[model samples]
Target: MGHPKFPSKHYDTPSHPWQKVRIEQEAGLIHQYGLKNKREIWKANTKVREMRRQARKLTANSSDEQFQKEKNLLLAKLNRLGMLDENAGLEDVLRMTPESFLERRLQTQVYLQGLSSTVRQARQLIVHGHISIDGAVARVPGILVTRPQEKSISYSPASALNSDLHPVRPGIQETFEDEVEGKTQDNEKVKGESEDNAKTDAKTDSKKDKETETDKEEEKK
Candidate 1:
């Protein structure tokens, strides 16, 4: 309906944009998921809102046979998107959160599958066309990964990320190991320093005691 060059806004801005609690929650999600900005969170929230709205409409028309079919279809779609379980009902859809939608994104899935060290890196790889879905390059990090697509997600055959020697290939495991080793070495160094300081203090106290004993003996003489 509108100009194709400028797409309609997919998300609604909050009524109270400066609300403290909402801002804190959004900040946590942004950091936890390594999101580019709050717009990603808003997009997920919009998706959840739409799903719940559809569920409400279906429930209100429970008497219609067509409604039942549509409800089943909706459930299947949500289930495929990993937002609902196998036995999930309309209530599950109604209870869905923005986080559930965000978790289904290609970036999150790629990170979860151990293809990248962090969500940010996953997004980068995807946006750079290093990732693929069903053997086709998928550049959109925000793509909703369905159940079938989940299995098909992998580094693009032509991408350097597919190589074992690639920097990001080892992902979290190598970095985690290096972090643990570094921490252990740091602890050992701190312990060694503490022991050395204790020994120095004990020697200083012993020397002072000896000096005091010698001075008392001379005074008595």
Candidate 2:
């Protein structure tokens, strides 16, 4: 028997060049939003596709009864996303791109709201439980945030606020330490050179003074 966590839609490939093109387009989206992988992108596409199918099915209905039901559900979802206008409909949902999905991702939200400087750091912060929605902590970087929650999203662990979102990340602290030590060494060298210069100047002045006194005595003779 297969293992519980084994391959189930876990190893699949796109069957067409159009699919390849879609994946390429989404890769740009992935990089833009700092997504972890293509799986997240596919999940968003599936949701959008299902919404489109539902809307198309309702469009064929004659009476207002079934249509209104489908429309209500669609509007509710779109409204939650803050993308539903008074006249929003199936066309609006169909028009959504990978960017729309990316915008709702916790990583993208964190970066947009200025909780983290870079997209990658924003992702790390979200995954590390440093972020929250409506006052409830969320540790999943892939969690899609809706509009009302989007405005209310915040970061927590107050002490973590002052620290770098990705503090253990390479390069930053190491570079800072290197620069600080280099400056200290440079300052000490400058101070020592300045003191030596001052002493040399004093000795030169005294030698000149002695020479002048000896010349005066010779003149007197």
Q: Output the number of the lDDT-best candidate.
A: 1
- TM match of model 1 to true structure: 0.79
lDDT of each: 0.91, 0.75
How far residue 161's Cα lies from its native spot in candidate 1, in Å, is 2.1
Write model 2 residue lDDT over 92-185, tens digit each, in one string: 7768765666677778888888776689988887777778888788889888788888887876655265455355433454667688999999
Give lDDT tens digits, candidate 1, residues 24-83: 999999988879999999989888899999999999999999999999999999998888
Q: Give the C-alpha miss distance for residue 191 in model 2, angstroms.
A: 17
Query: Which stretches of candidate 2 lie above 4 Å from their native place?
Result: 1-13, 17-20, 162-221
RMSD of 1: 4.5
Top-TM-score structure, candidate number:
1
